[model samples]
Structure formats: structure tokens, C-alpha cells
Target: MPAHRPRGAQRLHGTLPAARVAARATSPQAGGSGSATAGSGCVHSRRSIQVVAFRGERVAGRISSGDIEALRERADLASVIGDYTGLKRAGTRYKGLCPLHEERTPSFTVDPARGLWHCFGCGEGGDAYKFLEKVEALTFPEAVERLARLTGYELTYEDMSPGQRKALGRRTRLTDLVGEAARFFHQHLFTDDGSAARTYLKQRGLDREAAEHFQLGWAPDRWDGLVRHLTNAGFGQAELVDAGVATRGQRGLLDRFRGRLIFPIFDASGRDVLGFGGRVLPDRPPTTAPRDGEPPKYINSPESEIYVKSKVLYGLNWARAEAQRRDTVLVVEGYMDVIALHRADVRNAVATCGTALTAEHFRQLEKFARRVVLALDADDAGFAAADRARALAEEAGVREVAVLPLPPGEDPADLAASGAERVEEALADVRTAIEFQITHLLRTANTSTPEGQVEAYRRTFPLLARIGDRVLRYRYIRDIVAPVVKLSADRIEAELDAADQEPSSSTAVEVAAAPRPSEPRDPQLRLERQVLQLALQRPDLLPPSWSKVGEHDFTSPASRQLFVALAAAPSGGLDDVLEALPDEDTRRRVRALALADLPTSDSAHAAQVIDALRRAAIDREMAEVRARMDTQREQLSTDERRSLAARIEELRRRRDAIRDGHEGG
Candidate 1:
């Protein structure tokens, strides 16, 4: 028999055997007639039970319920939520545009008092943990762990052996190792052996302060320097290899990065170190040759358990808050560009990690800002790359994409080194993605000849056809394409129509048209919403006469259900009311009402709402009575006819009395 488990033992994802065994160990039946036999290596005692938990076929650990609750109580919902969106105070809550969806109005709201949030536009609503899970695309346990770390709350695990616990924590251990490796390299950057790398950085216009702020480091020009240093610091060779810092050579483990200046890449939170990017110094003495011959100018960490090249953006850790503040993100070509831009006070800049921009990268960028400006070089190759990126951004559903026009030979880093104002000026002169494409085609084409104009038109037709809005597409054709191509607007339109009708045109980029704003709702429904909003924001102002109103008085089923839930909710328990709501649609409606602006004179407004509801109810009854009289007049008896007529008259009188400010029964 096993010993009794302690209180607050949590149950995470697990198999049935683990669950049953854990229950038996904790239940009062232990050591009695109903006691269950323990499995292999299981130890049961009167006060403690030691067992392993399995999620599917893999070993898993659990977080205590008490710790999760403690984390929730300590975590500030507004602070965590405000990271992805700009929030302004609205009465007792905070309001912002929905980061999860495209909307012109502010429909996303946070109720700090209850630790809840909901977006009326997209219908995304949740507590802090759910919000993190949705925004970060993390699993439930990962969300909990992330929030716990942010709040500085330590968590305890249960129902796992030592081996299981270590296996579950492998990612954290590898991340810590990478962090230590970053520190080691950073310290080496200032040593006597690192003078060449230091000189190289200075020549690139980066001072010691900028280097330190970006945590720039130097990889010593040796095979086993980092390998031996990390091994001596209590990390195993396998761990170092797993962290992408060391590789297995014929002589044994060798440092992956050598004779280069290192740039540490961090997660978006700027806390966990994910990987490193290294730039080779031109003036350094030649080291041993590699088996693959001459090395490239730049080398980045290989993908491992913690890092994926396509999903990460360099400098995002430092640029997240600034991007949210400015509502734009400037993407450049290299780490130096990102560092240089930030040094020049263009703080919301990030770059890809030795790769081209990807759809995943654009999706991540959309979380922080609606607009993305590409600041790559203005050369031919850079223009081609920018076009590809614009297509990807559109496919990712990004709201706005533009490109900054730099000088013919200058990139962002070059401009920054020249002067801060130069970079700022270039940023302000950015053009829309379509405009840039059009301008590039015209400038590069030899428009003096008929062949050149036809070639330019052939290239520009696809770009125009990709525009989702018909009016916008036609405007571009009339204003730019017609003049440049030296063709009539009708000819271009016919060409576009012919291209669109072809089956082969499916390969062209498809842009989703923007959604039209919703029209105003019916006035009677608006009255019902106002009543519910009052109940949510200032229930104290609800008149005693409101008690006479039943669910049938409300025309909308959602409104009726919400009213019932609000009535049943305990005093001062808004959270309970939200929890009791039937579905997400109702909940979204409720949140919108709760966060909407209320009238200044709530007391008098409350009375007006009550009177309107009563008169509306009377009106509905009279309509039904008149409807019945007309429909059933031929078959109805004389008494039924008289009764229906009298009912309609009574309803009319009641409605008039209520409108006249006299209470009518």
C-alpha cells in the first residue's frame, strides 16, 4: 500500500493508470480493505506517495494548484495584456484596439478587477493565462510557467520521479547553458586576446556602450575554448552540444563559433537567451582551416530545441515595447542595421537571423504593430527581396506593409553611421508596397522605346491585379499605369480582365479585401443593450421597478440569458456573472456592454431605460394581438374578437401612460 498524498496535489495531462494510482494513494482507502497494490518502484507511506505521471507515452510533471492560484493573484493582468496592445483607461476598465483582429474602433477591453479580458470584434476573451496562451501560441502548462516567471512566483511540481523531472526541464537547462555561454563570450570581448574583435567593432561605428547594451561578444580563435570553459562550469559536453554552442569533431567536442564577433539572440521577452549569431573579423589572423574549406563571412547557431531561424527576429526583445508605442516595425537586413538604428533612436527595428523574411516572421510582427516598413538596401536585389516580403506579409494578413527608400548604395546601417537624422528622414519618406513596386518598375525601365514600355507594362500588370479593392485598382491604373505604359485606361482594364480570367493566373498573390464596418443595430435592441450595460457597470442605479420585467420582455435570446445570469449573480460578483454566461457570443456582447461609455446621469438614464423597455413590451403585445385579430377573424367567435380588441386598447393605453411618466400596471 502507498502512503497518503499531501493536499493540493495537482492533476495535469496524464494517463488513467497514473490518475487511479494517485487517487488511491491519496484517498482514505489506503492501507485498508480497499487498499490498492502499488506498481513497480512505487513507494507508499501514510504521509507521502511517490509515483510517476505519464502524458500519452511520455513522462510528465504537474504544477501544484495552490501555486497556480498564487501566480494568478500576483500577476497584473493589465501589465501583461498591455505588452501586445496600447490600452487607455475607460471608467473601471481599459480599452484598446484588438491586436488579434483588424478593427478601426477600440473594442478590446480588460477588466482588471476580475482579471478578465475580451475583444468584442474578434470575440477573444479570457483570463491572464488564456490571453498568454493565445498570444504566444503556447500550451497550457507553458503559459502557466511563463506567467509564473514574469510574476517572480516559484512553482512546485508533483507526481514525477527525478528522471522525469529532469527530462521535462531539458529546455530550461539548455537555455540556461546558452545564457552562460553568452556571458563567457561577452567577458572575452574585453580581454587582451579580443583586441582585434574590439577594433573591428569600433571601425564599424559601434562604441563599447552600444556593444555592451546589445551584449556583443567575441569568440576566441581556438577550437576548445568555450568547450573547456563550459565543461569546467559543471555542464556536460552533451548539454553544450544540445545548446548549439559545441559540435563533435574528430578530436572531440569543439566550439561551434570561433574567431568571430558574437551577437546574442534573445526571446521576445528579452529574458531567455535562445541562440547566437557570429560575424567574422576581417583583420584577424588565420586560424586552422575547416574540413569544408573557407568559411562564410557570417555563421549562426544551428536550430536546436530552443531556436528556430524562421520564427525569430533579431532585436525583437528590445524593440517590442517601442514597436507597440509607435505602431510600426522597421525591418532591415543585418544585425548591424538593427543595432545601428536603435543607437540612432530608431528604436523599433528588427532583422532576420541570416534568412529571408518569412510568413511566420510577419505573423509575429503583426502582434506588436499593424504596419511594417522594410528598410533593406535600394539595389536591384534588395528590391526583389522586398517584393517577396510584401507578398508574404499580405498573405499573413498584415494590415499595412511599406518600404523605406534608401540611397542607391546605402543601407540602414550606412545611413545611421552617416547621421541619425538621415535615417529618420528615410523612415518618414517610406512608400506603400504597391507604390514602391510601381516606382521601381518605371525607374528601371527604358521608357524611351516602345519595347521598353511594353516590357514594363507586362511586369506591372500582375502587381495591379493583386489589389483586392476594385476601386483602388482602377485608380492606380488611371493615375500611374496609363501614363507610364502610354496606353489607354480601357486597354489596361481589358488586359487585367483577360489575365484574371485565365486559369494560370491562380499563382498571383491574393489579397483579402478589408471588411466593411457593421451597420447600426435596431433601436429596440440598442435599448436592451443599454439596460444590460447599466446592470454591468452600475447595477445600483437599476430601478426597483425593473424586477417586474421578465426574460420574455427582452426580444433577443442572448439578452434574456444575460439578464437571467446577472440577476442570479451574487452581489459584487461580476466574475461570477461572466462565468455563468452560456457561450462566447453572449460573453462577447456582455463585455462590450460593460466597457461601453455610459451616460452622465445614470440614475435618470436608468429610469428612461426602464420606461422604454416597458413601452416596448406593451407595443410588442399589441402587435401580436392585432396580428391575431387579422389572421383569425374569419374563424374566431364574437367573444374572442371583442377580447382581442380590448387587449390591444389596454396595451396602447399602458404604453402611452408609461411614455407620459405615469407608472402603468
Candidate 2:
């Protein structure tokens, strides 16, 4: 009835007193097998409750409270997080910059007393297990085991016997198998049969050290080579298949990679070898025309339990620490590019594993560096990819995105092969996201005629509009676009706004659902916008004194909602706080703040601005109350009229108090 539960299945529940749990478990119908008896060997089979019993009460299926509580009690959340992020003591709490997203100041906090951590910037919050789950992308069981090992707390599961427990740790077993397979391939690469692969690497500028460093391998053309090695080493066929190293062919289970050069892909930590990227060998004296039905130049391990192509970066295991040290990361498109860049001494380099760049990739990179340089080919498709990636990075709150300028038909590998200085020069010529996008548009468009200029405008303006900062958007229109297109800033601004209003293909549904952007031309609304801008752009600079700038100070409904959100998160990222707001207008308003240049106001200047805004807001409220009193005076009863007068007097007094306070300060 309960889905034919497994013999060792466990139903996790809250803590219970030993006596009470045992009493309930020994009750009638708490069925068990073998020599298990009531009281001494009680087992609550239906509810899956387990109880400690006497030695004489033998049972077929075993259940116990085990060492779960011990595991939880021994885990130190602060120490666990401190390993990943540098933390400083903040009273009972520890604080550090959030690793989930880019931020200038620390907003991630850990409360050792409560065994919990939360990121004010990214809204990621959880206990130690959750922290590991997010940081390492580990599953719940994997996290538990990892922490258990760290704390030296051995966990015992009630639902699993010793044999099953050993077998149930499937991921660990698969990971070990993959690691061994990588070693086997590496060993194979150096044998007599691997001469051609060695030649290929040498020709590509990858020396012996480079190949060994990357753990380059050769998968023999014969299918049985890897199969025989792993089998003799005691790995089963199913385990090999699960690891994505072997496939079931018509003849039998065979190695997935055959007669190809192999590059092992690891997780960010460098311990787990998730999968492999294999490149096909080049033909001798290549034909003039390409052969039909030939496999693509490269093939990657299929999506498996251990490997998700989008989640694995080729060189991240090595690049993470280097990126952090350098404060920048280079994201390339291929494994060779990553290796070549590293050989050139550009150590902070990683590449996607045969997939398009994803937001997850950016998130992972953001943990190591604020800046990401996209090292892509000098072609239309490559530029388009770079533009898309830059847009994604901006949306993800990455501080800066740059594109490396390479020569025609060359990638980072080619450039590095020429000379390390050439690679350095190319890196030096990296262009900012918008600049690169503009260059891309100009390159693709025919700029010889007036219509071509219009085409460029059409292609580039939407990207410019994507910028959150209104001031910076206007600056771009005035400074960059005007001279080239010979169009007035006013005309360009009008068109940019018009183009921005067009619904994006990806976010059409969200655009329709979200409120239209507010017009902030009114002086009061402009101040309100500035307040929100400061909250987003310089969260660290926002002082506790500005708590006086409440929702009432914002005249616009959208502004009022945003103010409330910001007030709740005085030192939180706009993106994190925005997620809590129910109103679509407020969400849209906050996103707009992200693109805009931050207002250049220090804490003192901001305090004065807040004081002035509060005074104006009070005056506005009092004026409304006074008008209401004047309009309703005749129709109101005597008591009602008295109430109105009292309200108006109170409003005036509050307004006077604000003015007095400002003047005194």
C-alpha cells in the first residue's frame, strides 16, 4: 500500500525521547521479521519508527536512532562556511562577501550559535547542509556524507543494512570509477599505441608537461581496452555505464571514447573527475572536401548521474584559485583554449564543456572573480555568443564582462601558440560588454551608406537600452552614437525608449505581466528614484540614520513599494530584496536601478538628501490634509469637523518637527 517500501527504507522525523519511542514501537502491529519480539526488539514497521532493544530480541530488519543527532551536534556551520569565504567576526555572527553573486561589500552572514548562514545579496539561506549543497552543488546525501567525514561523525541509517549502505553510496562509487578511468586513459596515452595522439598534442603546442598537467589521455581504438582494464580492477559493467565511460553497443559494453584524445573534466574543487571531453584525431594529408557523415571534431561524455555538461567547466578545477588571486577569470570555448591560455601564464582560464554559456557558469565564476573575459573567436557567431553571454552576466549582477579581441579565424589556442606576448596583447585589448556589442553591430552592418548607419542603430540600441542606468544610457547616446550616426541625442533617446518598450522574445510573458516603467521626470519622484538608486548601487554606504526615509516619503506607488523593500534590507542587494516584493512595478523599478550609474553620494550627503526628502514629503502630506479639511468642512458634523481640524494640526506639527530637526542638524 505504501508503494512496496524497500526493506531498509527510513522515514526521517523529528527527535523523540528514547523511552517514548521504544514504548510506541513495541505496541501491537509494529511488525518485524526473524526473532524480533515486543519491548526488547520493537520495530514500528507501518510508521517506520525504530527503537533500541535488548540483545536477546533479534530482528531480521534492523532499525535504530543511530548517530544522526551526533552528526548534527558535531557540525560547526561557521567553520564550514569559513573554509569557502573569508569571514570576520561580527559579535556572535560571522560576515563575509556572498559567493553566490558579485558584491563589493560583505552581506553574507553566519550565525554559529544557530548553525545557519544567509546571503543578503543573493537570498541564499540554509543550515550547513544547504551551504554545502549550494557551494559544491552536492546532493543532500552527498552533503551529509561530506560533512559527516569532516566532523568525524559516522552516520548509521536505519533503513539500510551494512551491505546495502556500502552499495547505496552510489555517487561516491561512480566518482571513484571515473577517477580511475581517467588514470587508465592517461596511462594508455603514453603507450606505443598513443604515438599519434602524442604527435597531435606536440603539433598543437601542448608539450609533455602541458599534457600531463591537463591529464591528457588516449582512448585506444579497440573497444575492449578500457573495458578490460576497469573490469579486471573490479569495476562492474553497470558502474562503468553509469559513469558514462562505457556504452552498450550491439556487440557488448564498450568504451564511449575510442581512438581519440581525452581531456578529463573535473568539478571546481579538482577532486571529482566528472567526465571527459574527447577530440577526434586529424586525418593525414587532409582531403580538399570534407567527408560526409564524419563525426564532429569533438565529442563529450553524455549527460549522466555524475556529469551535466552545463554544470561542468573544463578547467575550473585549476582556474578557481588562480582567478581569485588575479581578480579576473578568462572563459573560453574549448579545452585546448583553456590549456593554451594557462601555458601562456594566463592562469585564470576555464571553458564550457561542449555547451552554450549558462547563468550557472557565470554564478560559479562569480564566486572566484568579479570580472569575466570571454575569449571567443573573431567571427560573427562567436561575437553573437559573446553578446548573449555578456547580457546574461549583466542580468546575473556580474560587475564587468569583457571580450578578448583575436585575429581572424583564430581562437585563444592559436593566439597562445604564436607567443605568450601575443596572448597578453590580445587580453590587453579586451573590450567592455557594450563596446564589444557595438563593434559587433558595426562589423556586421554595412556602414558605407546612411541606411547602414540606421541598421547599426537598430541592432545596437536595444542592447544599450538594456543598461539599467538611465544616466549612463543617455551618456552613451550623447557621446558614442551621436557622432557616428549623425543623429541628435534627443532622437536617439526617443528611439532607444521605443525599442526598449518592445517585448523581448525570451521574457515576453514576464514583460506583459510586469507594470510599465514609471516616468521619473517629477522632481519629487526623481529624489525617490535617487534614494532607491543609492540603496542598490552602494548598499554598504547606506547608513542606519536613513531609516527615517520611510515609504510615505516616496510619492509614487511603485517608489513606495521599492522603498519598503529597501528599508527591510538596509544593507541587502537590490536583487535579493526585490525578490520579496509582490508588486510587479516595484520589481521592474528595482531592475532598472541595477543598470543605472550609482548616485555619487556619501553617507553624510545621503543623510542630508534624506532629511530634505522627508521634509518635502511631510509638507506634501500636510497640504493634502489641509485641502481635505477645507473641502469637507460644510458637510461634516461638528465632531467630524473637529477631528479634521485636529488631523490637519497634527500634520502641520509633524511637518514643523521635520523642518526643526533639519535646521538643528
Candidate 3:
């Protein structure tokens, strides 16, 4: 996960406070809360402070308490969260795979009535604003402001000059600038200056509709074309440079992309424009071409406040909904492949931005779908890339990873250009990551000679041994490996056993290191967890005497903190407890406890659990007393020693009494 930082930290270079205020005033809210209604007033449920300034002097009035409450009421949380992960109705709540972590079962839940969401697996729970803050890495104010815009609830800055408002809002000015730049390039695409780019697109089989749908653009050959246009639009040179659309040149500011076709990269929501990717034109005149050494085929925006190249995937904004629907994402290698696939109605496809597939990219993909299929060209490079991607998928804990086999030298774009059915047919017959690896090995190996067959077996045996499922391993050895190596299944099994016995082989190491499910090591910790779970799920069943159990009674710090908050929480006020927690980790613990399913418990069972906690606490206290007595034995006076002995006796009696009560119950 990206480290959390304030949105203001991403301000444009040389931007003044006044400019920031203005940008905030004009910037659209980060996201919407719900349907928009025109009204004025503060709702005041959970107020998050927003600090704005007037004439460089700090002030506090931009986001009123009422506006936040109103936005909360208007925000459709499930809809907003659904944009990140798929959710399904589960009784009164909604459940889905947790977006924060990888898991098979649906442990993430949203309760619209309480305006809260929690993950039982990861223990992350919060309201809509908290949800946005964690998922998007936005600050609280940014989250609230985003939802405010989405719900059309206008946020007002009080007692500020218009300039001040503009300055505060300038925090979002860079995002707006990038968006404006996209429009500038897009508007130029249809002009005569873009004729070369248009011809290029046509040759690639992309018509005007495709261009318009993708908001494709063309950069003119002029050095300062974009610079002049943006400067004329009231933006500063530093702002333009900071936005990653222009660079400092010897003479003056120069357009970063010139004489190339442009593709705008948007955020996952397809709302905010992050940056751009430009491809060099094929027929550009030498005089208008790049003055720098040899022109690279492609150029992308430099890393900026809004865009992290490794973290962003091209075409994800358009592909998210379809990817979620299909439970798969087709990852290709270029912008044209994504566009081409979408044009062919294969909408669940995205591409990396002029880089190799990254762990961050895979992490983002996991949130949308369970499976990822690499749709690269079926050349040697594609096969090798797939091999690397499969390792990353394993590390990211993606449920299923596959490779789409295209014609030996063709990619998805080529297939799509030929016909939609060609691309669709290839997708239908994808290979699992393991199968692709075995096939690639076989294709590269000389299997006709006895020596070649032995070499193949040596290479393939380790791969087969790594399979955790015994049945699957045997099936692969029987169906795929045995025929290729001309080895019997029994012989293969014997070889695997011999390899397992070898201490130095990589196969032996991997097999020995296979992960095993861990059991809770501490019984007392388990008892504490049970007590807390009962408190969260069946509070009414808790005996009145259990109220006497304080936070100190629980040994684990997390459990202690949660117990304190739970005790102080009002009836049906789980959100209040969550808000009172000190940090995200503790809050996650509380949410997980609340969402966990506990066995059926009667009042007696609840009492027994609470009694067990009391006994444990007593034992802990007794141990402490005994340790102190031993450490200070010579230093203690007779009276002090007698007092310590009495204390220990009392604790023992209390423990025995609790045990007796449990037995009676």
C-alpha cells in the first residue's frame, strides 16, 4: 500500500496559498456521496476539520459540519465501494471479497443502515469517508470533499475573499491542469494538423468513433504549442511543468510531447486524468521530429504527484466494470492492444504504461478480479514475460493466473484488426500458468532423443513437485510429463521421492518449505477473542456481572483497547466505538471482531467465557506478585512480606471461586 499523505502535499510547484485556495474552491469533489439535492446547512454527525486561509492567514470555514453530515446522508456507500470490489446482498448487509487483502471467501461487509463497512478477514471497518481514505489513500478532508461533489452538495468557504477560496482549492489544481491538457490535445486530433495521426489510426483499424471513445489526441510539431495554449489559459509555467505536460528547455518551456499521437491515462474511476502516453508518428518530417538523439518509439509523462507509472494501468478506467463482471482481467502490453480489444468488445482488458507488469499493478488487479490472463504476443519475449508474471501473481496471492496464447508472432491488436472472433477465440482457450510453463519448456526442448528426454524430465520434475495438491501433481505427471519423457508414472513417483530425500536440490527445499496453516499458539488469547466476539455479536446474552470485567482484564493490547471502547459504546453504536479507537490497526481489529461469526451461545456460555477471562487475569496478577516477592525477598520487611502473601492468597481464592461458578453453571 502507498504511504498515507495529505492531498496538499501533492501541490503544484510554485503554487501560492491563494492559488491552492482557489483550486479547492473550483475543484470538483474527489467523488460523489449520492444523488444531488440543492440545500444549505450543516448535518453535524462526524465533523472533520478543514483548514483554509485568507490572504496567507490560516482560517477554518471551508468545510462546514452541516455539509459533511448532509453528504454522508446522501452518499450511497455500497455504490461507491462497489467501484473497487464486487459486492452481493447478504441478508441486511452486503458481503464481498476484501479489497485490502487476498482471500477466497467473502469476508468484507457493508451495512447501509449503520453507514459502516468492515472486513472480517482483515479487521478493516469504517464509514464511507474512512473507506475512501483507506482505499484511495486520500486524507479525510479529501474523502469528504470527493463524496460531497459526487452527491452535488456544495461546500462553502465562509468569510473568505474569492482569492482565498481559490488558493485553498489550488491543491487539486494539478489534477485539473492535466485534465485540461488532455482536452487541449484531444481537440487538436480532428484538426488538419492531426491528419498524419488520423491516417496512422486508420491504418491500425481504429476509426473516428474509437478515437473519440478513447479521447485520442495528436500533438502538433510546434515546440511551444501546448506551452503557449496553457499559458494563455491563465496557468503559470511552473504549474505546467509540475503537471508533467511541459519541460524546461534552453530557450523556454517546451511541449513534452510533439509530433506524436496521444493517449490520456485516467484514474480507475475514469474521472480524473492522471497523465499521458505518446507514440512517435511514423510519417513525421525530419525537420519536425525530435531534436533529441534517437527518438524513442514511445514517451510517457514523468512521475508526478498524481501519476505513479508502475501503479497505474492504461485502460483500467474503461475495463474495471467488465473485469469485475467476468471475474477476469486480460493484461496486454500496449495501449493499442487495450483499445483494440475494447473495440472488438473484449472490454476486460488493460495494459501497463510503458513498463513491465509490476507487483503494484497485480495488487490493483486482484481487487477487481480473481484471475489475470497475460494477452501478450506469442513470441519468445511474450512467453518469458508470462513466466515472470506468473511468479508475481503467486506472490500477490491472485487466485488464478493464465496466459492467452496468440499466433507465434501476433498480439491481441493484430488479432482484433483481423477480426473480433479471432481475438475472442484465443481468449476462450487460455492456458493456466503452469500449463503455459510446461508447454514453453517442451517447445524449446529436443524431445526426440533419449538425452533430450532425460533433460526435459530433469527440468520438469521440479516444476511438477512444487504443486501442493497431490492429485493435481499426479495428474500432470501422468497426462503431460510421462508422455513427453516416455517415463512411467511409477518411475516418475520414484524419482520425486528420491529428489525429496536429497538435501541440496531446489525441489527438496521448496517441498520442505511448503506453507502450512497456522494454529493459534495461546489458549488464553483464544479465550479472550471468544469473549470479545460474544460481546460484539450477542451482547444481550452477556451476564450483568460481566460488566465488571475491565480493559486490564485482557492481556493483549488490541483486545484491551477494544474492550474499553466496546464498554463505553452506546447501544447500536458500533461506529462510535470504531471512531474512538486510536489507530487503523485497532479499528480493524474491532471491525473483524464485530463481523466474525460465533457459535450459538446462551447466557450461561457467555458467563463462562467472561469467568474464564477473570480467572486468567487473576492468574496473571498472581504471577506478578510472586515474581516481585522473589526479586525483593531480602529487601522486604516482615510486614511487607506478609502483605504480599495475603495478596497472593486472595487472588487464588478469587480464581477458585470463578472456576466453581463456571462448574455450577
Winner by lDDT between candidate 2 and candidate 1: 1
Top-TM-score structure, candidate number: 3
Native RMSD of candidate 3 (Å):
23.0
TM-score per prediction, in order, is 0.56, 0.53, 0.57
lDDT tens digits by residue: candidate 2, 300-383? 888876687766788876776568767799987788888988898888999888776777778778877999988755555455
List ranges where model 2 is wrong by over 4 Å.
1-168, 284-292, 488-491, 494-516, 519-665
Structure candidate 1, residue pairs in collision? 2-44, 3-44, 3-45
All candidates in order of TM-score, best leading:
3, 1, 2
Worst 10 residues of 3 by lDDT: 18-27
How far off is residue 567 in model 3, in Å?
Answer: 50
- State model 1's lDDT: 0.70
For each candidate, the alpha-carbon lDDT, in order, equals: 0.70, 0.65, 0.70
lDDT of 1 by residue, 1-665 (tens): 01333453333221111110111011111232121224321111122222222111234445555565666667899988887789999999999988776789999999888778889888877777667656654434545656766655555556666676666567656866887888889889999978998898898888898877888899998999999998998899899998899999998999999988899987765556679998777745339436444555667899887788888899986786578767899988788889989988898999888766788899989988999998744545545666567657866888999988778767788989989778778877898877787778877888888888877766676467556577887888788777987988778777666644431221211211122122112344556776777878887888877787788888766779888998788773678898888888877867876877664335766877776777778766665565445323433456677988898888887777776767644
- lDDT string for model 3 (44-149, tens) is 2433354422111354344555556767877888987897799999898899998877799999999887778889998877777777656654445656655655
